[model samples]
Target: MRLKSRLLPLAVSLPLAGTLAVALPLAAMLHAAAQPPPAGAAPEENAEEPGLAYSVSLPETGDSALDDAISRASALEQLRERAPVDAFGLVSRALAEANNMRDALRSEGYYNGSSRVTVDGAPADTPGLADRLAARGASDQPVPVVITVEKGPQYTLAPVLLRTDPPGFPLGAMGETGLAEGQPARAQPILDAQGRINQALRDAGHPFAELGRRVIADHDTRKLEVTFLVTPGPRALFARPGVTGEERTRSELLARMVQPLEGQVFSQERIEKTRQDLLSLGVFGTVRARAGDRLDEEGRLPMTFTVVERPLHAVGFGAAYETRYGPTVSAYWEHRNLFGGAERLRLEAEVNRLGTTGDTSDTGGKIGASLRTPWFLGRNQTLTFDIAALRERPDAYDRDAFTLGALLERTWSPRLSYGFGPQIEFSRVTQDGVTTDYQLLGLLGQLRWADVDNPLNPSRGTRASLLVNPIYSMGESNVFTRLRAQGSTYFDMLGDKGSILAVRGVVGSIVGASYGGVPPDKRFYSGGGGSVRGYTYQSIGPRTAINEPAGGLSLVEGSIELRQRVSGPWGLAAFVDAGSVTEDPTPDFDNVKVGAGLGLRYLTGIGPIRADIAVPLNKERGDSAFGVYIGIGQAF
Candidate 1:
């Protein structure tokens, strides 16, 4: 029923009766003949040797939008005093601008508009104008040139006409093009209507559908009548796609990826979707899709996918610094197409606390390797295997651990995804001068939804993630479930003014285990640059008899920031963060810690370079006066 209502019968007649094409040529003639050049002369380009210098004047034209459009369309205003010209040359330049101004006015629905360019109150055809300017001869004083426009009453669209090359087409196709009669007759909307009609035709299974060449505008009735000549080419179904330009990746794998799209009705949206899917494999730097100009013998449209592969291998390194945490360095080596099939293998290492106030033994490091195979089960699915060895010496605990995990990730849509897997870990941790060894087996599940505009520096939209990991400690003979959820939302407070409001919140808990029974590293701790800035790492939670940090079973954290762009590539943020760590499984606010900070952000090609300084509002005796943090992205 919906389809029947949306589309007319295939035999619907499209006609162009009672239509007159009369006004566009006259407007064109007026603009073309606004200020014709003298006999046998042409406009000259700006030369190093100055001839005549002139200033341009473009006053407000009553309508702000028209004023802006005219100003932007004026070449005289853009060239300004930098381009010197003689009297004839100036007249030529001004004359050329009349067409541009006329087009600008027509774009805003003023079909009967006109423009005039004058030099020192004299028109271009004024007698002796060239001699007068030649006499000035590059003087210091700028010659005055002015542009004026007279925009007649705005025009509305008359009943628009539709014509099909084959004489009969769907009459309902025009409903969605926003080309209804009585609307303003702006040139852009009329052009855009044609584009929309073409896309609609393509969506309706005509792969080669396009606009025809008959756009007529009549200004006699102060109305525009657009004649959209639709050419609905042969409708076709999708055929097998051919792949090319692959050096290492298996062609069979790419073909299998597109198998689901074969035999469907030809639609541009599906073609683009397949193109993006191929690019998401990560091995391809570019992917292009082309539909055959002619159908095959089976009446299906053939498709071709061409991919340009990225470098097979790459290596990179980076470093970051914070006041107390000191400098951290990291490096990675990656093989994007390892063993082909778009498999990715990466090995990375990181070292932190290069020079801190603590002993040299307090430095921490990690070494890890991961491999990801896309299309593990099918399209939009991936399988990943990871192994890592890490050491950490934070204020709450000291740890040495080795972990192994295998995950299956699936993407349900552009903004939603989920992953689940099993993990194994072996670790020796020391806390409060007591050492303990544990072997843990865990199952982890994660779900994420992100619709933000930018991953590194988002200006709008919201993103959220939830993680649930259930672990059994073989040494302790206990099982615990860890649950954490975090979300952030950004608001563009002043459009085009570069103001944003970003808010974030996190809540986490450990159940089925006591606070002391859980691994210290897995337990929640608040403070430091990433948590409650201005306080030392893990210093805001419960403390032992000697005031050393004791990790908590529950956590609650939040941050709010107002980001304002002061100028191009430079921005500032003022933020407040608050958090609490509780011994009980349920979070409590009794010991909440709050920190306030100001940050400077320098936008870069990769992301923003961030530097922030904060002071604790509820500072205790040992908290620092202020803390400084630096990194390559917005602090979560």
Candidate 2:
């Protein structure tokens, strides 16, 4: 009889004629292979017998592709805590594993493959195998299982056909659906082609598309043919959208956030986008958007948004430590839905430099409150208000200030946003024992673009931002403008294994003012964990006679990092950072500083926890030999 075109569902096990010539007891073989027990135990006669153990071996097949497929599908390779306790259990498992190997070969395009399982010079299906195992006494020996496979010629695909009722759709334009003549005949590609056809129809405004498939195999030619029948249903438009699971939140507000207009063409893309928008509000724990099963009387598809609200109130606290700044602590309390329109209010406080050996006056703290309103006046827009009081003393200056500001931000797309705002500040500044009070009015504008693959741990993409702030000192005759731009790009060297190369650059300048006229806090300074790493904060700029820092008007910085994932939950990084601060408005590359470091990362659910140790490449007097920093997230 000839083999049929259909798959072989049952595994075949038969005894080999000459393989069992040496018939030795199973316990004797196990004893010779077992290792001695730990020391200081009772004598062998008095001790309890050790449990049975087993090991599996798969020899190379001379064909790399076939060997890899067998390794991936081999049940014996994936077993961890599933080892059998007795000889009978071991023989039963061996018989089942033979079937698993045969199925694995079929998935890889090999339809005529064969597998054999053997245990200690005998086939797994030997009659009276259980009786033979019972004859051996209890022994602390390990059993050996060997699996061998012979993968036949792979089958290729034959002519492929797709039929639709309309007969005018260009199916070829759907891009590589993975089904093509002369390619390998695999089950995955055939299923993928069916999905692609259905999605193409739906994307083209056919909301109710369906697909059916048929496959035929020819054993003589070793070829497979596939066909798909597509049903392109009638076109449909979106109907009025409804919201569910609303308690404290107003339905009208959520409707505005959804923004699905009636009579628009139905689109799966739009439905998914609406779901993401609702989740971004931070007020919902879950959001789902789906279309009605059938078209309405008017040929319109009704849409529904179901959501689960998050807790209205929350409180969080965090802390970090650095060699230069001691320990810093922060806390915040928030009301996610202060009013009915997805408004948020948060109050926060922070204190830094708790146990540092620097000047006692160089400690700092702040208290602030902020409010944010989503969907302000238009879609993808937000309005924010902030008020704060801060006191900080650094190497260059001391500041006591109060600030109030309002900003209006608009998100043009998923990757771009722009904002403009007005701020007022009243500050008391002290430098070199001289105290001066000033009131300032400023207008700030900012633009940002980011298309990173991930927000917490990105391996590829780019991020950039620009800010321009013009300020007028009401107490002094000083007017200056601060312009800054920074950008970073990430590249993945090894896909998904977390090997990445990241580069960043920053440049800034102060126009319309001399070095002496710029506010100490407003001027630029670089060197710290957030900057040049190895040096202390504000230590790279000009200095007084006593070696205290004097802030500068121009700044330029750049950094490069090579990150590699070591193992699960662990990673390693090597980096180099360089920057300069100049007194002139335009950077002259004077007094530049360079720092290099190595870091360790432990990945977590929220983000990566980082620890870095750095040394100054161009160390000056009074600079620390090295610095250590511990924090959350990437350095950028």
Candidate 3:
């Protein structure tokens, strides 16, 4: 068997005849075997016990990988430690394990490897071996068993050959099929090469490509030769896609999304892109695309888009706590496919600063409604409308406002987008004990780019956005242009989200207006859990005569975090944040404030639940010594 150059049989039959000889009761069987026996007692050939225990030890095979594989694949090791077996049963298991170990070696390119099994220092086939162990008299000691292997020289590959059934079918480069001469002929790599060939053919418009392989080993040269047989059906173009399983979503909306792919050359990349586009509509839980088995008369392939829609309506609530700013709560209700065109509508409300100050004027809450219409006027564009009414009392100001806005957003590519719209607002603001009413109209413009792998918890890539707003005050007759830009990037220090470095930066300014001329709600302030962290909400900017935040015309903020995953569903993060806000049109670094913090994270299906504690590095007389924040998702 050692020199067979092929895998050995792994199955072994139990010889019940050996156990039948010792079927008598233990007390009588032991006495008969030990002594010369009673005058009329029948002589038993082999003695055994009902309870037999043994431990298996595998010696080094000079190759650590092969030795580990043998231990994992051994049935004897798993059963002996778990199930109770008699002496004869144990011997039968050991005989089966010998062949398993040999197969393990052959999988690692050692076709000529050999394995030997023994019990109590006797070969497994030794006559009366089980009787020797059981005759020791029902002792509790575990019998010792040993398995050893000798792995010979590993096999290498001869030149790999690829053949197409139709002969000369376009397969591109066959030389780079991940197989080469003299490379180790391991089983996994050989199988992976076949998958690569099939995928390549499908990517080149051969949707029904099939692959077959033949592996032959020459023990004389210690080499394996492999040939991949390919059957590439017919080249195909994509036909109009058919959709199914849509309960509320309109079929015309889906057709509009896939119109660009119809009559085009079939491509795996395009299919994946179309699938992802459907999922982004927020109505589908899963989307799958399949190709027809037969090509049409025009040499075109029929495609189908199968979808599973998510629940049409959902409601959720969230809560967060901060040490000095007190607690905040929020809730939202959403309809995913309103009007049957995959339109989304949501209503939300939030309350903040609970249990902080005894005065009711210190608390704030707001309610708003938003709607999104997909495929609005164009395939790559969407229309969004929002209306909100809110009253908020932060350290910077106390104000009440009602706002309405609409936007037309266009997606240029998977990673880039831009939008522009008009908005109107009516507000009554109180700043530093001065109250004023104003009606404002503005033009809103925005640009965004994102290439991150995950939105809630990202370990790689960058996200960035820019906003420009030009507002005109009806009563004050003052015009101001607001500009803000923010960007964040993530580095995967250790692959697979085990360790990451995340960085964020922001800059903003209000041009053509003084700090006092702009409305308080529009002015930028830089403290709170989402900002500097160690101070109260809106607490880190320019101050008035009474030592309260006066809001600022310019702002700058930056943060850096090191995130490390500790174990399953748990992680840790350490971060530093810095920010500055000034009455000037540009940032003043001299007024920068810094905070340092550590956080704990529990990962869930939606995102990571995070809790952070931070201390002010440059503390002031009124600043809190430390701030604690709890919420969902990474603190970007």
- Residue pairs of candidate 3 with colliding backbone atoms: none
Ranking by lDDT: 1, 3, 2
lDDT of 2 by residue, 1-636 (tens): 211122233333323221221111212111211222123221211124333466777757676755665666555554413333356666766776665665555555565667898876679899887457655656566566789887667768888877766787666534445677889866656656767776777776678776665555555666666667666778788888888997888889888776655677777887777787788777999998878999888878988999999999999987777777677899999999999777999999998887676555667899999999988898878999999999886777889999999999998888999999999999999887778898999999999999998777789999999999999998778899999999999999878758999999999999998887888889888888878888887889788667778778899999998989999999999999898998888986767799999999999997899898899999999999998888888887
Off by over 4 Å in 1: 1-42, 46-48, 173-175, 213-220
Evaluated with TM-score, which candidate comes out highest?
Answer: 1
Residue 200, model 1: Cα distance from true site in angstroms: 2.0
Candidate 1 lDDT tens digits, 1-636: 011101121211112234455434222322222332232233565455455778888866687867767776676766554455666677777777866677667667776677788887788667888778777765678788888888877778887777776887776753466777888776666656766777788888987775652434554566776666676778899998888999999988999988777899998899988898899999999998888889999999989998999999999988787766788999999999988899999999999988685666889999999999999977899999999999997777889999999999999998999999999999999888889999999999999999999999999999999999999999999999999999999999987639989999999999999887898889988887767777777888888666788888999999999999998999999999999998899988998999999999999998889998999999888777888988898886
Winner on TM-score (2 vs 3)? 2
Clash pairs, model 1 backbone? none
User: Candidate 1 has what TM-score?
Assistant: 0.90
Pairing residues by index, what is the TM-score of model 2? 0.86
Off by over 4 Å in 3: 1-68, 76-89, 130-145, 173-175, 476-478
**Full candidate order by TM-score, most accurate first:** 1, 2, 3
lDDT per residue, candidate 3, 151-222, as tens digits? 778879889887887898765733358888998766667756776877787777778767776566676677
| TM-score head-to-head 1 vs 2, winner | 1
- Candidate 1 vs candidate 3: the TM-score winner is 1
